[model samples]
Structure formats: structure tokens, C-alpha cells
Target chain A: MTKTITLLLHRGPYESEYADLAVNFALKAREKGYNVNLWLYGDGVWTPHVKNEKDYPNVGEHLRKALKDGVNVKICSRCAEARDVVKDDIIEGIPMVGLFDFTDWLDNSDKVLTFMR
Target chain B: MKTLIEIFRNTPPGNACLILTKNVLSVVYGESFDDKIDEKMDITTKDFEVQLHPFPSKIAEENGIEGAPSIYINRKLKIYGVISPEEIKGLIEKAKPVKIGIIITKTPNANEDVENILAIGEEALKVGNQVELFLISDGVWVGKRGNTLTEKRLLNLINDGCKVKASRMHLKACGLNKEKLVDGVTISDEPYEDLVDLVMEQWGKVVIF
Candidate 1:
């Protein structure tokens, strides 16, 4: 069975180290042959709001690196709804899921890392 | 005993602070009954003692508060931001674990990440679990000896048998060495290996800050 790592992020881009570090960890875990699940909760749902950036760092773009490498990503629907985050507000192809979805990921994960404030 | 709930909010008041405060009150005590009276003064359940800790407050500073609307339950359990009533209930009812691995990745005093980390470690110890910590990035600064609040908490955790390891690379990057660190903080060369092993094999849960 392929080992899976669940990275639960609770912070958004430029807000703290979690967003940037979560992306970096996700990509590295993928490269190391681990299945990575990026679960965005709280302010983490806002990470996908930013697009391309020339001068500043856009974690979404860096997150794309992990996504392109088959890293699974999900955002909490409750958090999204509370923050008024619609499907269009986030990167395409990622699903907004319920908090219960995290329970399933937790059970399926070999390791769960919560990246919080 | 009234359940003491400490709510932390940093400099520059946040909407979440107010919202969380509102939600917590409403959760414990339903919305105001009197329609003519706008402000809800009714207390359905008066078991909770809520303390709002705005930034720069003496008690908050003494508590090593890291605000982003952080909440501490009875000065023990902590959760970031607001949570559902069900979730808060679950946190209170949570059980013990065999091992807990905590990673602190930020420099201390810049914020209260150290407080959160140390508190968790101490609680894990109190619960009779093996607690281990890895300090990476600028977080290695926490290993340095100091007379500050953060250091006191770290020392308490260490004295309580919580194992702490500092990243050698980060310690060097910050121009620090074994002599500069506190007595109990371990500065090992191959902590990444230990961290990986602990996260993958030993720890049932890993909380990174």
C-alpha cells in the first residue's frame, strides 16, 4: 500500500509560514513517492484566490507544482461558505468538501500533519 | 467550577474575535429572548467564564498568547480560531495518546507559537504520553537560553521529560551552537532522520506550528 500524508493547512498565503511550507512539503512528499493530501481549512481556503505574481510570491502557483504532480487537494466547504469562497474563487479541479471529508482522509492517512497558526 | 475560556486576539482587532465571541456566547446561551431589548443579556447557561484577551494586555502577555483568535480552554486545551460547538465538545472529551510529535518552525517572541507548542507538549506529558519536539527553520531560536516567558515554558516542558531536538543546520544558520542553547535542548546533526522516524513510526499525531 502506498503511504499517504495528509497536510491540513489552516492559514492562507503570505499570512504565515504554513501555506508556503505546506506547498513545499506536499511537493517534496510527492517526489518521495508518498501520496499527499492537501486539506485546506480556515484561512487556507483563500490561498487559491491569488493568481500569477511577478514581484510577490503566490503560493497558488507553487501549489500548482504539487497539484501537477498528482497531489490531492481539498478545501473545507464550511470554511469556504463562511468566507464566501465560491468554486470560481478557487483553482479549478479542486473540490470543496465538508469537514467530515477530513475524517475519511484521517483514517486513510499513514501520517497526518496539521499546519496551523 | 465555571469553565474558564480564554480567547486571545492580537494587535488590531479582528472580526473573527467578535464573531467567535458571539458564537461562543450564543452556543452556550441562545440568542436574547427579549425582542424589545436589543442587546442579549440572557444567560441560558452560566457555566462558562469567558475572558477576552486583547493584545498588549498584562495577563495575555503573561499567558504567552498567540492571537489569530486563538482559544484556550481552562488554560489547558487550545484550538486555533473558532470551532463548531460539536468540535469544541470533542476537544474537551478527547482521549490520551501514546506518543505526540510537535514541530515548531518559527522564531520565538515574534509571536506565541512557542506558547502553543510548549503548552501542547506539557499537556501531552501530563496525559502520560511520550512527547517529542523538533525545532526547525528559525524555530531553533527557542533552544537558546533566555529569561523570557517563552524560555520558561520551554524549560518547564523539558524538565517534565519532553524531549526537544533543535535542527543543527538552523542553529548554525542563526549563528548559534551548543553553548548558546539551554541545558536540555538537544542539538543533533541527524535530527531529520529522527523527525522522520518519529512522525512516521512513533507518533500517532503530529501538530506543526
Candidate 2:
């Protein structure tokens, strides 16, 4: 049976290494042939709000790569609203979800990691 | 303080109804005034012509509100206080063999987070749920011998059969090692891998700080 790993990212991008690590971990886990999920909570909602610029080592780019590589990603809708990050401000295809949705991921995951401050 | 909302909601003559919140009443009628309302906010619906009247606090006292935050549906007291969020979540979740994973990444003594974690960890174990704690980053400081408040609480969980592990790499970075850790605290050679195994295979739920 294939194992699933869920990563909950609670920090914003650029300000710290936490978000980048989570994205990197997700990519690495995916490379290992595991099903991966990325749940962006709290300040983590700022992660996908970035439309990455060229030539910069942006965490958003890594997140987009992970998303393209079959990583299921979600952002907290309430957190996004608090930061004034609308649906159009975030990366395409990622969903703005609720707190309970993270629990749903937790309930289904075999293993989970929380990347935060 | 909490406020309870209730609608008298009679037969209504048919299908029309009106709703007024406390906030709206304060804005219109002013918080201090008590006036006999001869005119009503009238609206005609398919069924009934409804009259909406915002009642006063004095009338609420007449409705058997001996204490505040009490609701009166129709001359009868309903909710007296508030229902906690935990109670609601518990109602949604079933009792099962749940393995709880806790990851601590901050220094303790600055806050009672470790104490809270100890309480939760003990309760989980008491209820026959498996509990695991991973001490990483500055969390390695929690594994020290004399952790003040953190040590006593952490040792309690360790003695209670909770699996407590510290990140060896973080311990080294923080100038701490296995020898300086609590008696039963184990050091993970590869914290990330162990964390993955803990979350991915060993545990069903996780709480990270």
C-alpha cells in the first residue's frame, strides 16, 4: 500500500526558512513516490499569494513545482482574509479551505509534519 | 460575557417574520433610552403583516433572566451559559485508538506551552491513546536536566509512558547532547526521518508548535 504524508506549513515565505523547508520536504517526499499534501495555515496562507518573479530563489516557485508534481495543496481561507489575500492573489489551482479541512487531511494521513516557527 | 438570542416565534399567522440584533437596536434607540413603542417596523409578506419591535433590558429581566446570558424562547429560559468549542469537537469525533504526535520547536519556561502539552499528553495516555513528543530546534532545550517548569512536566509525561524524543542535530546545534537530557528522554539520530516515521506511520494525529 502507498503511504501518505501531510505537511502543515504555518509560517509565511521569505521571512523564515520554514515554508521553503516544507515545500522542499514535500518535493522530496513526492520523489520518493509517496502521496503528499500541503496544508497552509495561519501566516502560511501568504505562501501561495506570491506570483514568483524570474531569477529569484522564491519559495513560491518551489511550491508551484510541488503542486505540479502531484502535491495536493490548500490554504486557510480565514487566514487569507485576515491578510487581505483574495483568491485571485494566490497561485492557480490551490484551494482556500477551512480549519476542519486540515483535520480531514490529518485523519487520512499516515504521517504528518508541521513546519512552523 | 455572552448573549443568548431567541425568537418568540408564534404561529406567525402564516410565513412572515422579522429579525433585529442587539447591535442594531443600540445604534437606533440608543443604549440608555426606554420608550414605549407605538409604531412598529412594518412589512407585508405573502402570509402575514409582521411587526418588529426591539425589546428593552427591563423586559428581559421580566422574562426570568435572573442572571445574564440566558435565553428565553417563549417566556421560558433556554441556554444559561456558553458551550465550549472542545465539547462540540468531541461530539464530532469518535473514541478510537488514536496516536497523537506533538512537535515542540520553542524554548520553554518563557511560556506554559510545555505544561499544557503535559496535561494533554497525560490525558491522552489516560484515555488509552498513544502519545509521542518530538523536541526539536529550540525545543531541544526542553530536554535539559533542569528544565525548571518544563522538566517536571516533561518528566511526568515520560514517566507516564509517553514516547519523548529530542532531535540529536538540534541538540548539538544548541550545544546540548543526550547526556544533558532528561533521564528517559531519547535522542533521534535523524530527527526529520524519525519525525516523518512518527507522523507518517506511527501516529494518526499531530499538533505542532
Candidate 3:
């Protein structure tokens, strides 16, 4: 049976390699026939707003690819607000949700991969 | 100073005992506590068939019983002083075989942490306990086929009966072939979530490395 996985991203894009690695894992999980859910919280909410700059792996572009590959992405609403990431400033497909939904996803998911700074 | 959990888990089930009341309560509340234990045991002891041996306080003291309501599971001392019925039941359940699930996400070069976890799993397997490993993230990088010392360690763990797996997506993303994984690693067709569920449902402990 297809198993569900939640990739919990808790780090920002710039300071560490956590966002790049987590996105890579999420993409890989999707390619492997797993239902992948990406929940952005804490500093991770900054990932969706990251612009592809010179000399760096474009985290936003990779997240877009993950979204295109059918990965379900959600951003923690409070975290997004705390980081000043309004709706239009974020990626198009990823929705802003609450921690309760994240908790619910945690309970129902078969696996959770956490990336922290 | 060992807690009941430590004593019960450290010793095998049938070979363990627990002594309660190594304090002034042994004199003041011993009789009442024993009576309560007897009453509770009548209804609750059916599942485990654990026998309770009661002796005169004099004989108990002779055996170095420092407390009241001493409990012996298989003949070894498991605890000392003050326990509830619910706690005893929990300890009994803990006496069974320990099931462990380990997830390795860091790379092999990341402080050699993967080797440590593999060693732990191997040790558990050597003692006839159950241990499983799931590799994800950069952890999948270790699945590459090679004769390196770390790879050999991983292969040794598999030879010792450890169930090793890697995330399918990680494998594909890293361009690793399932057929080429070091002699016994499986790239699960199911999602990473399922692997987590399988571990949590089947194992008694889950540790992420």
C-alpha cells in the first residue's frame, strides 16, 4: 500500500542546508510513490518566500518542482505571519494553515521527516 | 536508587521481583497495602499468571526485605517501596521482548553516527532482540554499494538479521539502484510514512539517528 509521509521543515532557507535537503527528500519521496506532505513552520515559513539568488541552490524553484510533482505543501499560518509572508508573497500552490492541522497530519501520517536549523 | 521502570526493564521478566516499602510505611501501612494488593490481584492477575509469595515480616526481614508490599515477578527483586496496581501492570507488559526501530537520516560522514546506530542494532540482534533500520534523507547515501569500512559494517548488521531499508525517493533522487544497494538493503515500494507506521506499530521503541 502507498504510505503517507510528512516532511516537516523547521529551518529558514539561508542559514543552513536544511531547506535544500528537506525539499530534496520530499521530491524523492513523491517520486517513489509515497504521499508526501510538506508542512512549513517556524523559520521554515521563510522558505516559500526565498528568491533564487546567485551562487545558491534555488529553494523556491525546487519547492515549485515538488508542488508540480504532486507533493502537498502547507505553511503554518502563524509562522508565515510572524515572518511577514503574506498570501501573494508566497508560492502559489502551498496553502497557509494552522498547527491543529499539522497535528492532525502528524497523527495520520505514516512517517514524519523533520528538518531543523 | 533504581526506579521500578529501570529494575523491571533491566531484568528479564520471569527472573525478576519487586519489593515495596523499604521505609517507615513498611510498619504503618504494610498490612493495609497487602490487603489492597490481594484484592486487586484477584481480578487483575489472570492475564500474566504471576505468582505472589507472602511470608511473615520476620522471614521477609531475614531475607533483607527493607520495605512492605515487596513484589517478586520470577524470583528477582524488581522494585522497592510504594507501587500502584496500574504501575505493576505496566511493568509486566514491559517484561516482554523489546522491539526497536531506528531511522538514520544523516550521511555516513556526519560524525560517523550511522556506524553507531548500526552497532547498537547489531548488539540488540546479537542478544536475540528485535531491531530494524530505515535510512532516509542523506542517510540513503550510505546505501551505495562499496567495500568501504562503513559499508562493511552495514552489511555485517544485515548478516546479523537487522532489517535495513532506505527511502525510495531518496534512492532515486540520489540515483541509487535498489539492486545495487549493499547486499540486503531494500528500497521500499511503500512511502516513507508507511515505514514509520510499520516501525511504530510493530516495535516497542523508535530512535532516530
Interface root-mean-square deviation, each candidate:
2.8, 2.8, 5.2
Summarize candidate 3's per-residue lDDT along B112-151 as a digit string, tens digits: 6877877888777754467888887678877778837468
Q: What would the per-residue lDDT of candidate 1 be over residues B1-209, giving only the tens digit for each residue?
A: 45556667765657776566566665445455233332223232466666667666887777766555777666666777877766765654552235788888888778776777788888778745778888977788888887376677778788888888998977997899999888899986865555555677677878887
TM-score of chain B of each: 0.53, 0.53, 0.54
lDDT of 3: 0.67
Q: Per-residue lDDT for A22 in model 3?
A: 72
Best by lDDT: 1
lDDT of 3 at B84: 62
Q: Write the per-residue lDDT of candidate 3 for residues A35-94, one digit (tens) a residue.
A: 889999899998888655557569999999999999999999998888789988877888
Ranking by TM-score: 1, 2, 3
Location of the lowest summed lDDT over 10 successive residues in candidate 3 chain B: B1-10
Per-candidate TM equals: 0.57, 0.55, 0.50
CAPRI-style grade of the A/B interface in model 2: acceptable
lDDT of 2 at A84: 92
Q: Which stretches of candidate 3 lie over 4 Å from their true place?
A: A1-7, A11-38, A50-84, A92-113, B1-89, B119-129, B145-149, B172-175, B178-180, B190-205
Give the whole-model CA lDDT for all candidates, comma-separated.
0.75, 0.69, 0.67
User: Candidate 1 lDDT, tens digit per residue, A1-117?
Assistant: 888889899988886767876787787677767788999999999988766664776788888777889999999999999999999877787889888889999999999888776
